[model samples]
Target chain A: MALTFKPLADRVVIEPVAAETKTASGIYIPDSAKEKPQQGKVIAVGKGTKEHDMTVAEGDMVLYGKFSGTELKLDGKDYLIMRETEILGIL
Target chain B: MALTFKPLADRVVIEPVAAETKTASGIYIPDSAKEKPQQGKVIAVGKGTKEHDMTVAEGDMVLYGKFSGTELKLDGKDYLIMRETEILGIL
Candidate 1:
């Protein structure tokens, strides 16, 4: 529960909840896998830009496209959150 | 290899490559199953605007955050491609 975002304009900042490599299911694939699964926790959300209005909020777990978001480094780790358009859905 | 994009000044259109339910792997979970994987193909790309530039081209398989990109419905199909920032990494 450690997340906060300061979005500029219509860009929403989200702190992706890191997916557990090994869930209760079984051993999760390594990052080396070509077709890997993406998981994350949301931290910050941006205001809607242009014609897009945001429906997601902070602290909401979400799932987005693997190819979405600009890779960002915060607090010496990885985190990503872009425009409301970039976000897919809340988990 | 089937993609065409008509981005509107700073936006890109992508045709998500639908992920195979049953791959060379084992049984793929049903959509009703939580923690599902998202897959799509790139179709269109928008021209750069403001402070962003066009990087990812059409037909390039990409991975994004689950909460990334605005969900769009076009021609009875679903697709999304925003700024280069919206795109996480090329797959």
Candidate 2:
């Protein structure tokens, strides 16, 4: 499935990875205690502005700040719309 | 006074602009109803990483998302530490 919405400027569309429910020590974390997920896969990219070149591309897994981006529901799935700058690094 | 706290990779320091207590029509807005300010002056910028070049400089006024950055008290004043990408535009 593809997104019909296209981002503008330096914005990007990302599908967030799910938060882990279990710890390394085998402790199961409840939903309320789970940390916000900060990793995602890039789904779409905007045309970069003249001064700022776009650095991220489609299908790149990336790390972002905990509170970064606007949340949205598209096609029954959660996504984030954020600037390319909000992406901490490509993994 | 200069801030001794230098930001690291892709981070920036900003001094937020105060929220206006009055509207353009001269209506007074109470503190409880005021929206968070999204504009600020860039106080410092981190050195750019190999893939991302630093674009902001000290003393530039910038726009950021309302929920962006971590708030901190440095030298008895308020400041926000956010990634350079958190900055929306330079003014």
Candidate 3:
């Protein structure tokens, strides 16, 4: 389903990438050891706030803090809603 | 000593109020059960950003999130430095 939800202020909606399940050396990582994913694809962005402009565009891959943003569910898919400042950088 | 530190952007420097050591009924509270103080007096304010103007001023007693802002020390006194957005309200 297409996302019709628009964020407010400088908020953005993001679809998180799954955490890594394997090591570079080919070792399988257990679910208990998997860290929260910090990377995601921007799906929607809010209009810039009075003092700042939106920096990431939809379809941009971005990195954020491990604990940033609020968890959301839309159209049965998991997403994150956070301010643009929460995004560390575009990848 | 007077505070000479100036915050940047929308950041503000605050002097936190000490946590309550007694209940409203005057019962002594233990250290382990004391909540972190979420109130502070604004010490210095930034000139704001390109998109937003600062909403607070020096000497304003404001409420904020318990975990918001960065802990800082200046001239042997503890302080918190945070963006104006982190301030929830002025009291």
TM-score of chain A of each: 0.64, 0.78, 0.80
Query: B32 in model 2: Cα distance from truth in Å?
Result: 9.0
Could you give the fnat of all candidates in order?
0.00, 0.00, 0.05
User: Where is the poorest 10-residue window by lDDT in model 2 chain A?
Assistant: A21-30
Please give me the DockQ of candidate 1 compared with the native complex.
0.04
- iRMSD for every model: 12.9, 11.7, 14.6
> Model 3: per-residue lDDT, tens digit, A2-90?
79999999999999875443222222222343332265779999997876777678987655556889999999999999988776444
Tens digits of per-residue lDDT, candidate 1, B1-91, equal 3332234445656666545544343434355634454544567765565566677776676655555655544433556645557676666
Arranged by DockQ with the best first, the candidates are 1, 3, 2
| lDDT score at residue B14, model 1, on the 0-100 scale | 65
Cα error of candidate 3 at position B73, Å: 30
Ranking by TM-score: 2, 3, 1
Which DockQ-derived CAPRI band holds candidate 1? incorrect
Error of 2 at A71 (Å): 14
Rank list by lDDT: 3, 2, 1
Q: How high is the CA lDDT of each candidate model?
A: 0.55, 0.69, 0.70
**Tens digit of lDDT per residue, candidate 2, span A1-91?**
6655455558888987655533334433234644444767898787776667899989887778778887644444667778888888876
DockQ for all models, in order? 0.04, 0.03, 0.04
